[model samples]
Target: MARQPVARQTVARQVVASPVLVGRDEFLALAGRRLEDAATGRGHLLFVAGEAGIGKTRLVTSISRRAERLEFAVLRAAAFPGDAEATGGVLLDLAGDLRRAADAGWRDVGHALSARLRDPLAAQGDPHRQRRLLVQDLADLLCDLDPGRLLLVVLEDLHWADQLSLEVIGRVAVRLPGRATLMIGAYRSDELFPRTAMRQVRGRLLSQRVAEEIRLPRLTAAQTATLAGAVLGRRPTGSEVAAIHGRSDGIPLHVEELLAASGVPDTLADAVLVRARALDPGVRDIAAAAAVIGRSFDFDLLTAVAQDAPETVDRCLRELQSVYLVQAGADAATFDFRHALIRDALYADIALPRRRQLHERVARVAVERGYRDEFVSAHFDEAHLPGPAYWHALLAAREAAAASSHREALPLYRRAVRNLPDGSSPDFHATLLAALGAEAAAVDENAAAAEAYEEA
Candidate 1:
């Protein structure tokens, strides 16, 4: 799940209204002009970034609505928090749009897209030319979708997007110049630091100087009060506003959660758990298992981790949805916790032994399904099953190194060594250290390389 920047803290107060999007007049004005520009055949790339719960989605929804008012044909797609690996997952959300456009005479383009994206459920093809061809076709499709009206494509939660999805969007942004289209991407800024696939996407786009980025700032105390007033239909007392701002740090989601979860629990996790406990114990158990599995989890995966019958998990999910704890994903079989904070709370509240057990199940199921090496390794590490953890870590490290992400591979190799159980073969430690040393040397971290070599 996309994480909150702030440490766990209490939700502000117990109040509720449709989310009040305050203090973004300037951004909305800028967005309006960009839409007008798109209508005039001047395309744009707008990057909206902020920390979790800072109203990134609310702001973009506002932009989309404004664009609609201007008669622009808008298409929206969002990447699942931790499960965006399906091929063209974001673009595939527009399958309905593509079909409709086909019926309206874009048949050849639609056929081309269908052929290229024949198996949207599978991983994308690896060849550069294949990806470029698909991206080019998609871009042309966008321009032709509604030749007279401007087209607005909004990709949300990009920090969770797969590399192929990011690459496709980046390519579209570049090709949209002088076309009647606007591309907007929203991602968590806090998650894009130092090293991440999303950072690489941003780097390429920024280098081209083709996109304008707007980083949403935390709300000011005054703005917080306005937001609170709008939600409650009455201005807050001065003390209440101060409390909200202090606890929430002016992040809209935090403020909203705090307001809705009044009674002032000491931490956000506490508030979230309080709500979870209000649901059926069975439902809550399912939720905890889902969190242990991953934020964005499928029905089959949850059932496996829950060790329960499929029907049982489905019933629990229905109960959870009644409380707005989890919502069905783009695919009805998949579900996501409505908020990352809630998942954090549930996962954190699980007993250590139970967490280990659940993680072990997740690792076993992932290995059985031939899931990505990183996920398999991650669950094993969480399970603390030293032998399997160590071996999977090594595998994950090799995968990362093969991708030229040597810096990322280094820590995985270190994890392999750290998790080596007693009586392990001497060669195990030697091999792990050798891998670590190689990665460190590749990154020019000679001291690290020497240390690993000495240990080996």
Candidate 2:
């Protein structure tokens, strides 16, 4: 067989910059024009939304840099995960910058936060007064700092915004048109649902006509190829480019991982496996289990698989979330892989025994939870252990039959038959053959489903 050509090894780190702006020249140009308009005293509120890693932050950073050249006063705030010391962390950060711009005279802002707001309620004079005071303080600071110039206030990752921050942001959105302010807020669209803080803030902004939302779509295949070339410093081969696009679903961060892992010895899968192996053992183990269970595993399941104490698992989970390696589900107490490539790399690194042990645990837990036999069988098949493999195939066939997917089930039964011991009963062989024949006959061979079944 002919060897595949190596992807051009550019001496560059994969560009996983925030707001990874790629192939959206027209959109970016339009955004720049809006910022320019805002800088020229025609301020507008622009809300940018997309899935995580779609480049919202990168786009905003680019705009901020351009706004700087235009002489607009730029202020920024980023939301934090939990109860960090800084309650209004974003506001405090912006206030710090504003104070600096004002020759550090408004040091009172920092003093009030550090001294008076020692408790979450103390900052406001009381809990009920907190929201109103925060808004007033922010508005006052903005008005004070810029006196007459256009101001751009960007709040990134508002999906994690505290209630106080969201309320304050809503107020700012309502009040921006009258002021020389252009406030841009960016968040993950998949995370926006009714009744959540983000959704509520968005609703308030829309009702006030103070916000214009821009939904950032994934990069096109050509754009992705171009981005890969730019990052790699040379064009990728057709197959390598396709692999990057397909695996990343056009998400820039994922595309970077796929491209960066391309030239390592072994297949892409092996490369992922190798990288995964280099992680700390605890993280690596949890990551492997996450991959096997597929995206979005329950905390309870992780606990069972890792077989660690509750506190240990909790600490590990926090570490994962902190690094953006995993994200919590919006509605459920579940965690999902941060990126598809992470899962791919993890599974590639998993050894047979470890995979089998984890899968066995999965099979037991899933069965106890009343999950379908097919899911359980998938775990068993992935386990690749001896006695369980045959049982898994039978169960797979049974479940697939009920779902009208016998065409998909035929291969499992055939594999089971081939793997049966030499002393197996004649009746077992006949039963397996019969199941395969029936499955083959039920579907038209020309159909795509049939083709997949045939290949399997």
Candidate 3:
């Protein structure tokens, strides 16, 4: 018995809210202009690459909207995760558009495809064969029904695309000459490492010189501030602007998250911390470790703190990169938390005991390596141990002060003052008082300097 066809919803709903169109004006202009040119028979190919959540989709959406206004036909497809659709899936998507445009019911198209491909079940074959026939049908239909209409095809998240889809795209790329066609693809460069299938497709595209690649760099400080202001509906104070820029490092997605988290009364740091606490445990841990280690961290250090097998850590890192919580470094040897705010958020998420343990390990590693005393002291301050911990921490602060890193020394001195046992020796008290005075003087805080001297 022939089964009934499952009803499928074809409505195209907008998933993104009002996006604050930050940065990337130049790139957007170039893409828009090229697409416009393509509609006039100057066909070109564009490849937009960036890290995940770096606004590739948003940019492309803007271009697509503009193209529609200019009367150009736009076709879009996105790759899926595991259970990736084969090449036929992309072809099927293209074919559906062709069928719709012809005003020919799918049934008629299916009959035509089955007759053309010489398959009895051409209308109801497995998705793969259906896709193959669909593509063939689509190409023929395009030629038959409006061959002169400009068509702009966009494939997004190509990193997740299946091998067959990539091959299909390669075939389309080779056949684009003299046709009213422009193909645009977007993918995350960090995840598309050498030797992968995606990389192979990229290599073919390059060798053909049919693709023009545009790599989006991180946002500038001014651009970040402008974006934050737009998101918040007000100008950011100097401190707030600096805080967001420092932490977010100009990633549009991070900037948006930070603004949403900041709310009306809370500062940027507080907002970042709040958001960080809400992430999944694995992401939060990786973020925290990255923050403690600074902008970039070694994988070995992360594994040491997480106490997980290498593969487990690698998996977590990849997840972090996927959501833009972290980024892999250029050489692929190090990983970085995208923004300082993310790091702070992650740091605040961990259990106190685990944080202390991680800090202790970091401190021990620094001490064993004869690293700068100040760096070691910073870890001790983080560890929050007692007795000898306090003394070693104090020594680290003094070293920092000697190195003229008064800002770094200030927290250490403050911690020592707060944690020192009561009724301590006068000499120890006097030394701390003097160190605090010196730190204040270095920062030109005369009033605080005088107060420290008075305490001494």
TM-scores for every candidate against the unseen true structure: 0.76, 0.54, 0.49
Q: lDDT tens digits, residues 56-117, model 3? A: 87888888887888887776655533202122334444454444454454335544533442
Worst-scoring 10-residue span by lDDT in model 3: 9-18
- Compute the lDDT of residue 94 as modeled in candidate 3: 49
Task: Give the winner by TM-score.
Answer: 1
Q: Give the lowest summed-lDDT range of ten residues in model 2.
A: 1-10
What is the model-wide C-alpha lDDT for candidate 3? 0.64
The 10 consecutive residues of candidate 1 with the worst lDDT sum are: 1-10
Candidate with the greatest lDDT versus the true structure: 1
lDDT of 2 at 290: 70
User: Candidate 2, residue 171: CA error in Å?
Assistant: 1.5
**What's the candidate order when arranged by decreasing lDDT?**
1, 3, 2
lDDT of each: 0.74, 0.62, 0.64
